[model samples]
Target: MNLGLKTAVAAFALTTMALTAASAETRVTYKSAKTGSSYYQMGVELAEAMKAGTDGDISVTVEESQGSVQNVMEVRARGGDYVFTTPPALVGLAQGGKAMFEGKGDPAFDEIRALFPIPSLTMHFVMSADSGVTDISGLAGKTILLGKGSFGATEGEKYLDLFGLTDQVEIADAELSNAVAALKNGQIDGFVTAGSYPAPNVIEAAASTPVTVLSMSDAQVAETKRTKLTIPAGTYAGQDSDIATTSLPVVAFTTTKMDDDTAYALTKTFWDNKAKLGDTSPWWNGVDPAMLSNIEGKIHPGAVRYYEEAGIALSDAQK
Candidate 1:
């Protein structure tokens, strides 16, 4: 072979190796919890599905974190390949909520997208029934602990923003576990948690202490509409007959960085295995595969591919 031709062939071989290695090494990080909560479990399920559906073209690793806020930061930093998060936190990150990233900075809204609209998250404000806190206003002058990051904060802020309760309530932030402990120890007058129905932590906290789960009033619900929200039915625990409550919408967010093929694969795998995931997590029972269309933020290209292939129409914005 000519000397120049030999060099060219060597270079081509090296480039091919590099590309193959990169493709084979594509890794996805999924953050959830170690305690095996339904949310975390669902994340694991999705990650596993993606890996399997892609036939090892992509590999996902599940890790535990402080839930949505941490997931958002990790994915934004490229530390996480994908994240499972609820809508309010996704919006809060977009709006730059305080104490986020330890004030490192706000989440870059443009870099993020919604993979799917998760089932509704019932915002739980647990107060002793005897505490005479029948309405949101009644919680005023009491020491309240909202879940850490923005889970609890969003609910309290939303309620306050909507009901003009800024001057009425005193709010503090606490991790979900700590907030539950605080309520049990009488260290806090009330504890707030926003999650899918029968949130294990809230249920455990409520069982330990007699408490009431406050529902959003009509006006408060209206304000929530200003943000992207969904209220699917059949998602609550003890939510029938005795303590019935309506649904609230929440979305599972992703980043814009996910490639079209990968995103489509993930979306397709999730929908295909929806029944199994729902059976494992009651919170997902009523999630209509059809509702994936309404998720907010920019739609991912992969998701677009998957939906289109599934015969679901896409908006121009999605394409």
Candidate 2:
């Protein structure tokens, strides 16, 4: 080969190597809830924080999803690298392939790993005053609205089973917006949703109708306590008193496919900038350092390392 041709070839190889190295920085896609939901907003905030904290070493992109179940499926499909999910949905997917994942494509859910918990989603059983359904027990023979393909429906069914009202009540599945409209038009006696306090749909429904947030029976509350779930007082409009209800921890997780160093960096970035991220949503205000230890699923080795360095202990399930 001519000397000029050899020089050109070497230069081309060097350029290609540099470009590959530049593009090799970790890039993660985070699947969040629907556009207007709190989870979506939180995901955006977390992504931004990660980008800034990592100093461009990692880039996170946010993707909108239906909710917990969809988020899990997306991550499993390699559509995203991380997702926001609740314990019930994750456990459902992991345990028996039940709930929204029942009979769907097979995914190794056990391979999913937990990163951290954000906040708790309180279950709200809201009924119109005119429906005369003041508490959970009053829903017998009534049509109740549960969001279509939502974790809310799964939790609602569990509530029905606990109260033994499954057969006695008619379950109507609809989207949140549609469910709110149905509740306003008296098409449904009650609506069951689980999310952060002051959910916009619940607020809109309460604005249109005289609604009451039902409290769980003592027995029901006792049963839920085993899972460390609780609903605090005055979570929504017209909910003047404390309501006893179950809650599920909202956790961020990733699959085992994610590299240990990247997961460690992402986890550290989130917690290290918790104060800054808290300003993005009211949910973050409730984030406690201790909650990091209270997550489900196997903790990613990377996250486990970061937590250990930060002096946070992992729960048996997380370990």
Per-candidate TM-scores read 0.64, 0.71
Could you give candidate 2's per-residue lDDT for residues 121-182 as a string of tens digits? 77889898889987788999999887775677778887788788999999885766687789
- Candidate 1: worst-modelled 10 consecutive residues by lDDT: 233-242
User: Candidate 1: lDDT of 211?
Assistant: 70
Model 2 local distance difference test score: 0.76
lDDT values of the candidates? 0.64, 0.76
Candidate 2 ranges with C-alpha deviation above 4 Å? 1-25, 32-38, 64-111, 130-133, 141-143, 166-176, 182-189, 222-228, 289-294
Candidate 1 lDDT tens digits, 1-319: 9999999999999999989888776687766554466666766776766666667666777777765656666654673267556554455544464555445554465567666666666666777655667667778777777665554567666666667767777676566578767777777778776667657786677667767666556666566563333333322333232332334455666677777666676677678877776777766665776655555446777777777778877677656
Candidate 2 at 256: error in angstroms? 4.3
**What is the alpha-carbon RMSD of candidate 2 to the true structure?**
5.1
Candidate 1 lands at a TM-score of 0.64
The model with the greatest TM-score is 2
